[model samples]
Target: MAMNRVQFQSGLSLPAFLARFGTEAQCEDAVARLRWPEGFRCPRCAHDQAMAFRRAGTPYWQCKACSHQASLRAGTLMEQSKLPLRTWLLAMYLLGQSKTNVSALELMRHLGVSYPAAWRLKHKLMQAMLQDELPRMLKQVVQLDDAYLGGERNGGKAGRGSENKRPFVVAVQTDEQGRPLYAAMDTVPGFTRKALAQWLAQRVRPEADVYSDGLGAFRAAEVAHAHTVVEGEGRSRCEAPSLRWVNVVLSNLKRSLDGAYHAFGFFKYAERYLAETAWRFNRRFHLEYLVPSLLRATVHCKPWSEATLRGVPTFRTEASC
Candidate 1:
């Protein structure tokens, strides 16, 4: 048996990450570069030149023409955050590089922040990850499966009827050799054909071949290129060759959720959690680039407020994947 290259790759170790983005200045520079890779242009006037200054320890860039001012944290997920840039960068690094998900409590210990702050930070980053994943559409050969997170409580209904169970869909695209390529996973309202149809429309390309289990809802895949059903009796779904990658991805996803946070409000936050796992899985091959890539995604993500994350009156209900 040979070693797994992805598992053995020289990822960005903590020491290396610290050396590169250990300080506020370094983190600030990294954010600046990610935001304006070509150079700073005025958000208002689009001027090529800007003046840099520090106000109460916060870096700001002023447009040379319009005199418009932009804080380093402005316009991105970091906006209005009181946390240091180094702390934000560190959170991104931890969440990105971890083989499994990190809990808010662990992040609190790592960042030395209060639990609420850590929770907010974690959700905000996860929201950014979800945003980054929303535009991805799996193509070519794909394996699809319906999965659920959380199990029955002591007094709750059992099996699929469990109120605690949060239904989600998982799809993995494979190459010619059947190696996994990209994964798309998200919480859906249920296994209804309407729900699955909406999910297929978003996460799968029209010309892609979708192979799934005998779930009737998956018949909705006809909305796409094709849907093939694979069935195996008296055998674990994971053991079935046609369903291999989807099952493997689900196994890893469940393990990560079960091992990381002891519990969460599955009905309320399952989408974010599922997206976090899928986001990392989709970017699994490039361990070293995880932080930078995550930073770029975060840079493009609009600011997410606590009210929005909490879902308020609009707390995320499973309308679609």
Candidate 2:
């Protein structure tokens, strides 16, 4: 199963994808190939000339010298997972291809899995997609603003005034044309100085020029960077070459969230979805590059567990209790 990078990019049709890597046996072979590109090695003894065989119909590599056995799924995301590899691959494709966002219900129908299974699958992929490293700093002119996101209100105002229903999110980034180069979103209880500062410190680079409305939270940002505040009617920062691009960028962000993921809940999971959207927006033009990159990411990444997939808080029992 040596899949070429180009073949993967053209997009794997549902039937074709299943035909190639649908069965559990096919999946194990794919994982084995991915895990040991050159040859199999024993996990415990570090022996390369290990004899691999199936135990209980599951592939296990046994070290010839020490007879140590290890499953192919060990140390991989697919470890301890019952979901089919084809199902996982399809889920990844759907998540990657979707322009807006895909809901769990939608995923359930798409993958033909249970609602709970679909929900868990979607978040697990999202968790893997989240960039662990901090994004590169937004250089040049950066647009800074806050927007609220969540489900529609029962009888709320048409637009802009329906802020009460959803949580407020702050976004900061630079855009080239309509593509965001760097972006970070944070869910806030409300627009407060403390919340804004915490987000800025984490996402924004020091000494970057900051632009915003007359929000006092940005006032402290001046300590480490150049800060400009827009005030009064008809005041335009767009005159500045660096600041002008933010207009298109901001519009795209709003359109994406409003059109695609109409409503999202609190801060924790919201950030993951935001990151997912940002990845899509940033790579819109480079689909050829983006598709393979996502596939490669899936290779090393582990399948997310049910507990981690939900993003719900889990309580640990105290020894004292």
Candidate 3:
């Protein structure tokens, strides 16, 4: 039989990545090709032709008709950056391929860059990956659960009541055979029926069935689709086959967060970190596509800075979008 897409596929090896993106020009060419496959059209005027202008080692284009200029990184997440394209590509490779949490320190060591630069690059990429999650509706059957991050602080109240814990929901949609299909996760102000309704409207197809433990908020699931409330007994609840993927996913999420980031603040950065986890899990099968896919997403998003990444988080509210 041919290889199944479900099986994990190896991504670009270090040697392969080095060979392909060894030089600044090579990385720039790759980005340009991925960003505009057919040809370089003026993003402003939609003109099809431009004159090449040199910038550092990369090339920018001046539109012949409008004289509008745009750089390779100019309309992308990398806009206004001083770093080379090769450095950015290498960072993408390391972050994309690493199965576990790789810290900014690791990135600094790997890229031979300063601590601050590495940290900025790492957070930028993480923010990019988080936004890269497409607004896909989960269909058929979905496993829904409420989860919390933080509260590891000793001497504080633990579990749901802790002030330190930030609550979020995990929803994983599965195929008819129960294989995992797609997942959606995000931070919520609280696990209320109203919150569930908002999340359902955003992430769930109105026709799909939602499986969850007996939570009052989940009952609101009926407002959109069929809701089956199943409360398992004891450890069996956490190990139920119907909820297998979510359980495994939760376990891995905790491990990756704890293992990779030893001394980091979580309260301010929880959503981006969790979004990174969800993105990585959803794109697990096609490991090779992860880097290129993220690169494509970066091109579509507006440029942002480290200060903005730290300060201006785009919170989701129904009225806002």
Relative to the true structure, how large is the alpha-carbon lDDT of every model?
0.86, 0.61, 0.80
In angstroms, give how far residue 317 of model 3 lies from its true place: 3.9
TM-score of each: 0.93, 0.70, 0.91
Tens digits of lDDT, candidate 1, 1-321: 999998888889999999999998999999989888899978888888989999999988988898999988888988968999889989999998888999999999999999999999999898888888888899989999888888899988999999888888999999988999999888887899988888888888999999998889999997666888887653575677778988889889988899998999887888889889988888878899989988888888888888878873111233221
Single out the weakest 10-residue window by summed lDDT for candidate 3. 312-321
User: Mind giving the per-residue lDDT tens digits that candidate 3 earns over 1-321?
Assistant: 787665556677888888888998788888899778999999899999999988655688999999999888887888867888889988888888888878999999999999999988888887777777647678898988888888667887767878667788888889989988778778777889988898888888998988888778888899879988777775788788777777777788888988987756556677778777888778888887777877787777778777777773343452110
Q: Which residue ranges in model 2 land beyond 4 Å of their true spot? A: 1-49, 55-58, 65-68, 132-136, 151-179, 188-194, 232-264, 299-303, 311-321
In order, how many clashes per candidate?
Answer: 1, 3, 0
Q: Please report how far candidate 1 places residue 258 from its true position, in Å.
A: 0.6
Clashing pairs in 1: 311-315
Off by over 4 Å in 1: 153-161, 234-236, 312-321
Order of candidates by TM-score, top first? Answer: 1, 3, 2
Q: What is the lDDT of residue 111 in candidate 3?
A: 91
- Candidate 2 vs candidate 3: which has greater lDDT? 3
For model 3, the stretches where C-alpha displacement exceeds 4 angstroms are 1-8, 152-163, 312-314, 318-321
Error of 3 at 265 (Å): 3.1
